[model samples]
Target: MPFALYLLALAVFVMGTSEFMLAGLLPAIAADLEVTVGTAGLLTSAFAAGMVVGAPATAAFARRWPPRLTLVACLFVFAGCHVAGALTPAFPILLATRVVAALANAGFLAVALSTATALVPPGRKGRALAVVLSGTTIATVAGVPAGALLGTGLGWRATFWAVALLCVPAAFGISRRPAGADDGSAPDLADEVRQLGSPRLVLALLLAALVNGGTFAAFTFLAPVATGVAGLGEAWIAVVLVLFGAGSFLGVVIAGRLSDRRPGLVIGVGGPLLAAGWSALALTAAHPAVFLTLALTQGGLSFAVGSTLITRVLYAATGAPTMGGAYATAALNAGAAAGPALAAAVLATGAGVTAPVWVAVALTAAALAVKFAPWWTGSRRPDPIKRPRL
Candidate 1:
């Protein structure tokens, strides 16, 4: 893998921290901005919405620009948004900043995915992608916790300032292109749009959405399940989250090694096990040992399956390399947004915390069904080995 890939991962680490750290900062933000917690939560929703909308839009608009330029511009905009968010005294301005920041985040991620794959051999795209995405898994384990600690010790705005400063080095690193890092010919917008007409690409996107949706359905409610259902103490919440993050890191690494060569095998074994893990968690969450064990296993299975599906999207969208990452990003964000909302609905029905686990099971099962459907299974897929550069 090229060193530039690591720089992209570093950028992702900063952005991912900003993305996930809000969960811990909402209380402080609500009190400071004089808004209800529920209203403050809308910041997350705004970010997710921006990601879903901005991925393809930004990719299309920046199709003609050099990859490095697009990445650096997005990083600077993202950092600027954080600065604005930190200095803003009013809630509305902060909300607007979140939306803009998310747009930049989406753009950066899309281009980074393309660039990462471009930096590697055709056979190692999966590993390259894993290297880049591991940044997010790492952020979950370290960056988010550190951001929360910063928020607790200083203020919510301090976390924002920290994230902005973190972006500086990454942006500077990405601005300098290493040898062999080519600004490839810009992908034709028409060709990119045309790729969406492929049913395989469409189904791959749906699978990506379902896989992530199932994962988030359970993940978003983990705190309540750990404390109320699993009989774990409040302090153990962090332990379970850290355990899950560790498992996810392992899963992505394993997926990287296998997905390029045996995608079908990775998905085949992982898909059913992922659903079973969710089912087990839903049924046995009352047992602390079982809950904790399943937390790790399920996290691994979720990322392994999700990463494979995402790799499939890239393969299926070989005709639209520039836009392929945007499509995958949009689908994942759509799932991320939809999953928590559906899980919240289940909770609103007074279905108890564990009900979301069943939602996860159902979503995973649906994804499996989609993956194995006659149409998808029978369709001739793109050969990633023969695919062209982005």
Candidate 2:
């Protein structure tokens, strides 16, 4: 791919890391802000909700701007949000900061992806996007863990500050890219909106929710799952998250490559592996090694299929890629927002942390049903999208 894609990918990494770092800092935020742990959790949800709404709202107006410049502007906004998030003293203020950050996150990913797609030949769009998006997958594996560790070892405030520092370099890198390397001239909004109205896009977005919900269910409560069900030492949860990240990073890389060749197969079957892993995790929590392996495998399988799904949406969107892309990000953020609460609800009822695994299996099976439904037929063709955070 071109140097442009890499730079956009790096900028995306910083944005993704900054947004998701809250997971690692939840406990600290609760204490610092004097809220319940559940309330701290809401912060993440609020941010995701912002993404879900902002993805389209931001993309709606971005059609007039060149893609690279749009991406750069978003990064600048992202950095500003992080700066506010790190320094804000009140919980409500932090929430506001996160909301702004989420909007920027949505814009950056959407633009970066739209640009990445244009940087390559039409036939190779999926593969090209995978390379740029690898940064996001890598963030899941590396950035989140490091942010968590920074909060644990140093302080939660330090964690946001560290991510903020990352944003500066990310914005600078993106700003230096060539002016029009990935800018396409097509007006994609109307076509993309029409595609979004299709059964395929709706089904795929639903699939994203279910798949992400399952992954989120198991992964979000990882700390408690390890301490309670698995009976593992608390010390190891951080290490396990990092290990899960490793699996996810590798999975994203492989999935991107696979999607370029066989997206339908990859997305159709991806949940099965994720379901199987989550099932194993719920059932074998007493077996520490098995539990960790299941977590790792789930990370790889669930995430690996994302680019394939995104590519399919993009291809289906035809002339309109931005809304198509924004829809995926919206779906993704909505799914992520749903995961923690869903899993927490299950665990709240004293079903143990495994309640979510059951939810995951059921949701995955439901997604499969829709994926193989009669109406979902007629589109074996590869598709495309615009930029939005995953």
Top TM-score: which candidate number?
1
CA lDDT scores, all candidates in order? 0.89, 0.74
Model 2, range 281-335, lDDT digits (tens) per residue? 8788888988888778877887777567777666655466556667777777777
Q: List the residue pairs that clash in candidate 1.
A: none
lDDT comparing candidate 1 with the true structure? 0.89
RMSD of each: 2.1, 3.5
Total backbone collisions for each predicted model: 0, 13
How far residue 307's Cα lies from its native spot in candidate 1, in Å, is 1.0
